[model samples]
Target: DDSLRRFVTFEPRANVAMSVNLLVEPTRSDADAGFIVLQADRAHPMSGSNCICVVTALLESGRVPMSEPETVVRLDTPAGLIVARAACRNGQ
Candidate 1:
């Protein structure tokens, strides 16, 4: 229902509370290269053969996003990362 999908509150990422983990935050690019790359941690608690994550466009920068449907991307363990790219535009 509409109520179930409504925005409730703004929640800040708790991981940012630590300084060192800043390097571990979700990677972002500003190269104006018209693409986004995603690397997933295999051992990520939410990962499975059918597990998936949502990639979203950051509104402040005005970059377009791309997504693949039902992609089987998760790996077995956090040994190697899976790389996926999404197209973007810099208004150029």
Candidate 2:
């Protein structure tokens, strides 16, 4: 049961069948959003794969969409999108 709760699997590679894990949370209300971008290493999961280095987020609020991460603006990759690691937890 805890194992199921310990991982958020997502493929970093578009074709090689690999995944990565990252964690993020809002520190306060009225926050835009945040991320836990892990540095790539030989021991990382998303490593050794064809990483486009891009990720997207799908945000939802309890009541209104305004209180969620609505807009996405990537500023770090070839496509101008920062790479996203997978979320290894629930309630994302």
Candidate topping TM-score? 2
**Runs in model 2 with CA error above 4 Å?**
1-21, 42-55, 59-92
Clashes of each: 1, 3
Model 1 / residue 24 / CA error / Å: 1.2
Return the clash pairs for model 2, or none.
8-88, 53-83, 54-83
Q: Once superposed on the true structure, which residue ranges of model 1 sit more than 4 Å away at CA?
A: 1-43, 46-79
What TM-score would each prediction reach against the true structure?
0.20, 0.25
Model 2: lDDT to the true structure: 0.31
Candidate 1, residue 37: the lDDT equals 19
How do the residues 1-92 of candidate 1 rate in per-residue lDDT, one tens digit apiece?
32211212112322222111101333334222221112221112323221222222222233323333321222222233444343333421
